[model samples]
Target: MSAPGRRIDVCNGDADGLCAVVQWRQIDPAPAELVTGLKRDIELLRRVHARPGDDILVCDLSMQRNLPELLRLLDEGARVRYFDHHAAGEVPRHPGLRAHLDFSPSTCSSLLVDRFLGGRRRAWALVGAYGDNLSDVADALARGDGIDAHRRAQLRRLGEAVNYNAYGEDERDVLIPPAELYRVMVRHQDPLHMLQREHVIGRIDALRTADLDQALSLGPWREHARARIWRLPDAAWSRRVGGSLANLLAGQCPALAHAVLRDTAAGPLVASVRAPLRAPRGTHELCRRFGGAGRAGAGGIDALAPGDLAAFVEALEAGDWG
Candidate 1:
């Protein structure tokens, strides 16, 4: 006995996650409530409260992070359908759980959803790959589908725009919320159509690029093999530019790990770090020093007090890659 009519969809508010749900709903069209937040809000299943006989769809979040909440939901009688490319520590066998989990470099939740939906939404799949920075993978797939290089570039740009929009400190820093963007996007069948017509994509790209320019204008940390840190003044612009800063630093100095540290509201500094893209390592471990966490390649700190800035800088300047 599966639940009917009581449906809830929850996913990370990034392009990959939302597009994953888009593919799913296209395959199984139904009206359901959506629970979503920012790109950093991947642990959203914890926020959902539902009774037994409810059908919940979750995507693009770590099952390991959501384990406790997932168990609670199942115990409360909610059946779950989960799709993800993140790590899932261990899963319990239960009749009520349906998981479509894949952890692969070329895959995102949207691509997985497209696969599950029998490739009915391949266009969005390209978008997800672009968002996830899987350019080689995205380019190859688009070519396989006989997409023109120009169209492949368009999808890549759309992917970058969509991915860029998901960044920022929180909801206030974004141009538009992911849920609202999803609403606008779901009206179209092909994302390539979006590439041609949607102004939101251009706005997002322009905003992100402008912010990146500002960050680059701030100059470099001028350090050696140690971590490179750029201190950002507290501003709405800084908040919006955080992700782009990390990316810029990563590309500008591929051999060194980078951190973009910005002042927050309460006098503490927030930081986003990226390991060497070509040799990504130790970022997660390094961020742990400031009470943040992420995977091997990227991570951040929630807050670092004023006194800690110098120490943090010293640590960054002395970052040991050896």
Candidate 2:
């Protein structure tokens, strides 16, 4: 008799990705090889190697970015199940692939997984929604689940802390590598229990708070009637704080689009862009003009030329985000 093929899981290392995997694994309880990395590592599919008859699970990574690798895996006879909320340009028709993709501004990969599982792990889904900066949606879901206000706050913080930990340029800049954090996270069925039992959550939250505080002190680098932009030097703290800072700014000033640019060791800049919360649209289109892609509400550029800063600002100021 032949042995069963390997089970491989690939996902973004952010809260939504990790929580989606956690929910699936909790229900399945099967051993699988996990491939994940920092939030900036969007091309994680390139690192995966699947064999014929192997089972591959993907979450939260952009299908547009990983299309080639996904096609290769399918051609190699591996069955893949994908869950994501990113902008998928064109989904190929393949019998070996099962895709769950939703591009709604208010939903996330975790919530999709929760819906797939019939809400068996709704609390984890709430944490992921909050981490993805969908507080209003998460709150509504929590209310439906009968979660009290205090517990809702706890889930939000937990989600934010977990999401914050995934922002670094590399694993060294983060308090804990996301894979290690996932191991700790998977052991707890209840996110609230993890918050109470683990000191790591507190440690990560403290570091996030400190980094956000430092980033806030250096006010906006550029501001316009419709947008605000901030620039950060290439440092460990700045690398760790960029995405979280952008999210905070978006929440604080929902009337204007926000851009957070961090200097990279390379000559180019890395950017996080968020559309105005009041009218979340056009971010993906805006980023695509500069060779980046994401959902409508949020997008990022891995390497934006320094020379294009003015053009980027001008575009932001004139963007039809609604």
Candidate 3:
């Protein structure tokens, strides 16, 4: 008798990705090998090694970035399930692949998972939506589910903290590794219960607050009628705060697109871009032109050269995000 193949779960390490996987695992509760990494580590599927008959589950990672590896896995005879809300260039047809992809700016991987599970784990889904900066969407869902104002607020905070923790150049820049955080998060069926019982969430939230305060104190490097850009020095705090800072700035100025660029020790800059909240679109298109990729509402560049800064700003100023 041959042994059964392994169950491998691959996802991005951000709040949306983690929460999506949490919802699935909570319902299934089967043992699986988790392959995840920091926020910038979008190409996580390359790490997966699946054999024939293996069951592979993917969430939140961009299909465009992982398509080659995914095709290889499918050819190896693995059965794969994928869920995401990213700009997938073209989805290939495969008998072994079951894809649930939505590129809508308002939806995210967690919400897609929620729809699949029929909202059996709705609270975790809310955490993911909030973390992805879909506050209005999350709020409405929570309210419809009869979740009170206070609980909704708590869920938002938890989502933000978990999402914030996924930033940073690497694990050392973060307060906790995302995989370890996932171990902490998956223990509780209700996220509110985890918030009440675990001190880790509070610790992460406190650090996020401090870092954000420091970032907010800095003035914008460039400001325009339609956009604002902030540049942060190469520092641990800056590395950890860039993505969350961009999200906050976008919320504060719904009419203006926001970009946060932080200097890295390796010479190139890391950038996080958010489309105007009033009209969220075209971010992925912009980033793709610069050799980066993301969904329409949010995108990032892993290592933007200094020489391209002027051109990037020019494109930002000229973009019709709507």
Candidate 2 clashing pairs, residues 3+ apart or interchain: none
lDDT of 1: 0.77
Error of 2 at 26 (Å): 0.6
Where is model 2 more than 4 Å wrong at Cα?
none
- CA shift of 127, model 2, Å: 0.7
Q: Of the candidates numbered 1 and 3, which has the greater lDDT value?
A: 3
**Per-model CA lDDT versus the true structure:** 0.77, 0.93, 0.94
Ranking, TM-score, top scorer first: 3, 2, 1
What are the per-residue Cα lDDT tens digits for candidate 3 across 183-266?
999999999999999999999999999999998888899999889999999998898899899999999998999999988778
lDDT of 1 by residue, 1-322 (tens): 7545489999887777878887777667788888888766767988888788999999888787789899999988989999887657698688789999875444677888878887788888888777765666778888889989988888877777776777777788889998898887777789888767888888999998888888788876555564677878888778877766786677677787788888777988888887776665566567677776655566677787888878777776666543
> Which pairs clash in the backbone of model 1?
none
The residue pairs that clash in candidate 3, if any, are none
The residue-by-residue lDDT of candidate 2 on 1-322, one tens digit each, is 7568789989999999999999999899799999999998888889987778999999999999999999999988899999999999999999999999999998999999999999999999999999999999999999998999999999999999999999987899999999999999999999999999999999999999999999999999999999999999999999999989999999999999999999987889989999999998899999988878889899999888989888888998899987
- What's the lDDT of the predicted structure labeled candidate 3? 0.94
